[model samples]
Target chain A: MDLFINLAHGFSVALSPMNLLFCLIGALVGTLIGVLPGVGPVATIAMLLPITFGLPPVGALIMLAGIYYGAQYGGSTTSILVNIPGEASSVVTTLDGHQMARQGRAGPALAIAAIGSFIAGCVSTVLVAAVGAPLTKLALLFGPAEYFSLMVLGLVFAVVLAKGSVIKAVAMIMLGLLLSMVGSDIETGQSRMAFDVPELSDGIGFVVVAMGVFGFAEIIRNLENQSEETRSIVTSKVTGLMPTWPDLKASAGAITRGTIIGSILGILPGGGAVIAAFAAYTFEKKVSKDPSRFGRGAIEGVAAPESANNAAAQTSFIPLLTLGIPPNAVMALMVGAMTIHGIVPGPQVMTKQPDLFWGMIASMWLGNLMLVVINLPLVGVWVKLLQVPYRMMFPAILIFCNIGNYSINNAPFDVGMTAVFALVGYWLLKLDFEPAPMLLGFVLGPLMEENLRRAMLIARGDPMTFLYRPISATLLAIAVFLLVLAVLPMIRSKRDVVFVEGET
Target chain B: MSDGIQAPSGRSGGFRIRNQQDFYGGLVLVAVAAFALWASRDLPGMRGFAFGPGTAPRIFASILGALGLIVAVGGLVTDGPPVERVAVRGTALGAVLIAIFILVSNYATPITAGLGLRQYETVLAAIVVLLVTIAIARGADRGPLYVVAGTLVFAGTIRPLGLVLASFISIVVCAAATVEVRWRETILWAAGLTIFCALLFVYALNLPFNFWPRF
Candidate 1:
């Protein structure tokens, strides 16, 4: 009863004229960025974060949330039209969606993708509202030991889920943790890694690091890929905007199963839209009567992953909103944005700011609806946008990144730091080390440190208390199990095969 | 399974010997971890019932050092592709541009003070001319040159030229980075973006910034 009343209040807030307008704008911009290759949501959000500084917390959060899910919808457009996955999560869509486009079923593939995503979005928004409260309650029971163990588990999962060498991923996590210690220590206020620079006293800004690594490094990588000059985009004959009844019948089961899989996986630490999409496509192949139909215009291939990614995108917020733990880099950026808005995300957020919490949940549903309406009609516009040369697009992105970094503290030093990190990021990419794990570590490092110190203090430096507590012990055990699973030769081989297939 | 550690074909180039990207990456991480550990050694640790600030960092640093060592060892034993060559020209040009921006932004006042210049604007103008000439002489790509010019100009002139004109100049300069720049399109984009940013950032959001230069 209370949930319904709260949801009603949420609808009132989200439906208000001002909030609705922001939601529409966020969704629109999210779609635009999502359609543009190489400009992922992380860079777009970081670029636009400064604009939200003046918005009321509710309006600001609603807009950011809209952008996230909106990107999921927009990502499919490029995958189907140009055979290019605009976002990582949309990579699986290119396998079948593009094939469908070549076969003149582009309109049906896109329409099904949007519909599946909408269904998943609606379901996952309900899941967020339903599960958010219970999870917050569970989180309130966590002690310092439990929280520290949770972070350890989270870091371990980050390594397990990362692509490429496990050793490199672990090293990146450690490096990120080390980098996070550069500012004044939280406990003693002693400057640790400042090197006598006053700016270092407060630590490197999260926006600077994100923009440098994801935004600037990405630009450099795009430039390095000189072979991408001749792109073949399929914009002609985009007929059949709606799926046939037979297509709908075939995908209904896949969408339902995908929603379930994605909703569950998304709540787990280090499980996000990309993993969920990959997992769903693999699951669809396993369950299909003819698996070979998958990369060759299979509608189930398009529907299942699309639904899974959208559901996962929404459910991935559960950890951040309830536990204040960011499961991925995108969520980590959300944490940064929330902190800037003076709202520390944790269990307390729901209890203290019920309107903000519920309004965001309700707005997710509204945003999904807006995306369906906005995307179907604006497909032509997005296709035209895809025609813009990367050369022209990159400069605008660079300018926004520069202005965005400068706006953070009205300081030139941050821009300098961004340039430095961009170089580091490009180097890391050259070495085949994924920067995503490092980002997760950077975001979680301070919280993990604070909890570790508190836990150690409470246990009188025993360290065994983590093992003694049931929840912490269980979490630690899971981390160990994941590590062991990752190392086993058989499982490692199998996982690599799966990842390689997905990559292709 | 035995060949799992090998670099996937086609990714390696001349820089790496024996496809040792992991080896080099591991070496860098180890160096960083060793430095962090050494630097934090002097900080206070455990005191009475509470853990000191250094305790957490030391713990993390030690773990990181151990991980780095393991990765380095793994990298050495694994058979993989040769390391790829770094984009030296692009990287160097980027570094130089950033260096100039930082140097000018941080030292413009001191440089002007030493030169006994009357106004900061005059010093800024002189620095811009010198940097732009150097950038062009070095055969820097239009992208980096434009970025350097835009950022430095925005930083130096934000206070004097105000938000609108400074941002306009920055955006236009940045738009000119591309090879296929059309003057009409660039100017229109510059004007539109300038007005949109001003309206959104300054007018609607009411950020604490000047609309026009005070001087």
Candidate 2:
């Protein structure tokens, strides 16, 4: 009953005229970027982050949330139409989604994808509203030791889940931690890595790092691959915007199962929409009577991963909203945005700012509805956008990036820092190091350091105190288990085989 | 499907042992870590029971150094592709542009004072134009040139020319970098994008940027 009243209040806030308009704009821009290859949600969000600064906290969050899930919807459009996954989570969709397109069933494939995503988005938003309060309550119970242990577990998960050499990932995380140690120490006034620059006293801005690593690096990479094959739309005409009865029946079960699986995985640290989509696809293939049909226009293939990724994208907000921990790079940027708005994310956000919390929850449902209405009719417009050459597009992207970075602090130094990071990011890419883990580490570093210091102070420098606390001990144990599982040759080899199979 | 938009997998070329990327990457990390460790030596640490600023960084630096060693060692035994040659012209041009921005932003007054230029802003603008022209002449890819120029122009001119004019000029310059440059279309795009940005960022959102040059 109380939940109902709270949700009603949330609806009142979200349904306000201004908030709704921002939601529409966010969704439209998100879809635009998502349909364009190379320009991803991370860069797009980072670029648009400054725009949100002037918005009220609730409106800012609602719009950003709209963009996050809207990108998931738009990603499938490209996967089915152009045989390109606009987002990483949509990679698996390209296999069967493109196959269905090739068979001239692009309409049904796209319709099912949109419907599946809509269902998944609606379900997950409800799940977030229901489970988010309890999660926040639970997070409030954590002590400094527990918090430190949880962060350690998060870092381990980040390393284990990254699809490359574990050692390189660990190194990247350490480097991020080292980088985060720049500026003045919170407790002591001494600067760690500032090297005497006045700007170093405030630490490197998250926007700088994000734009540099993801935004600029991506632009350079796209330029390097200028000879990429032009994507041809699979069909000029998208007929029958609705799926057939049989097609609907086949996907109904997959959608339900995908929503469930994705919801669970999305709550886990480092378990993002990308992994959820992959896991759901693998689960569907394993359960299917005709697994051979997976890569050859399987409707279940189009439905399941699409649903799972959307569900995961929505639920990935759970960790960030409740526990103040970002599950991935996009969420990390959200944390940056929230911080810029003078709102520190965590358990307190739920208690002190119920309106903000519940309003954001309500807006997710509204945003999902907006996406379906916007996408279904606007498919042709998106297809037209697909024809825009990459060369023409790159400059616009670069300009936005420049203005975005500059607008953050009105500092050209940040722009320069972005340029430097772009080069560094490109180098890291060439070296097989994933930047996601480094980002996770950077975002969590200061908090982890603070928690570790507090925990040590409480323990009076006794390292064994971490083992004495049940929650901290359990979390640490899980981290160790995951590390061992990742390193063990037999398990590692089998995992690689599964990933390779999925890749093909 | 092609992993085109995803993060790089570092498996672009055929396998080689000699110039392993991890080897070079590890060396760089190790050098950075060592430098960090050495740099923090002067900072005080471990005041009473609580850890000081230096302790946490030292711990991180040491771990990074160890991980770097392991990665470097693994590179020796692991079979992987050689490090690909970086696009030197693009990279150098990018560096030069950044250096110029930083120098102009930080030391513009000092530089103009030293050179005794009566109109430092004009001199700075000329220098930017000259650098970009040289870069383009030296076969720096036009794509990067546009990006560099746009960023530099926005950074340098935002104060003098304001948000609207700065963005318009930057966008126009950037649009010319494309393979097929239509001046009319480029001008239209620049005008459209500039107005859109001005309205969205400056008017509706009301971000604290100068709409026109203060001077």
DockQ of 1: 0.37
Candidate 2: give the clashing pairs.
none
Q: Chain A TM-score per candidate?
A: 0.96, 0.96
Measured against the native two-chain assembly using Cα atoms, what DockQ does each of the candidate structures obtain, in the order listed? 0.37, 0.36
Q: RMSD in angstroms, all models? A: 4.0, 5.0
| Runs with alpha carbons beyond 4 Å of true place in candidate 2 | A490-504, B1-19, B87-93, B100-133, B136-149, B172-188, B213-215
* Residue B166 displacement (Å), model 2: 2.9
* lDDT by candidate, in order shown: 0.78, 0.79
Q: What share of the true interface contacts does each candidate keep?
A: 0.41, 0.53
Candidate 2: TM-score? Answer: 0.91
Candidate 1 structure lDDT: 0.78
Tens-digit per-residue lDDT, A334-359, candidate 2: 99899889888888998899989999
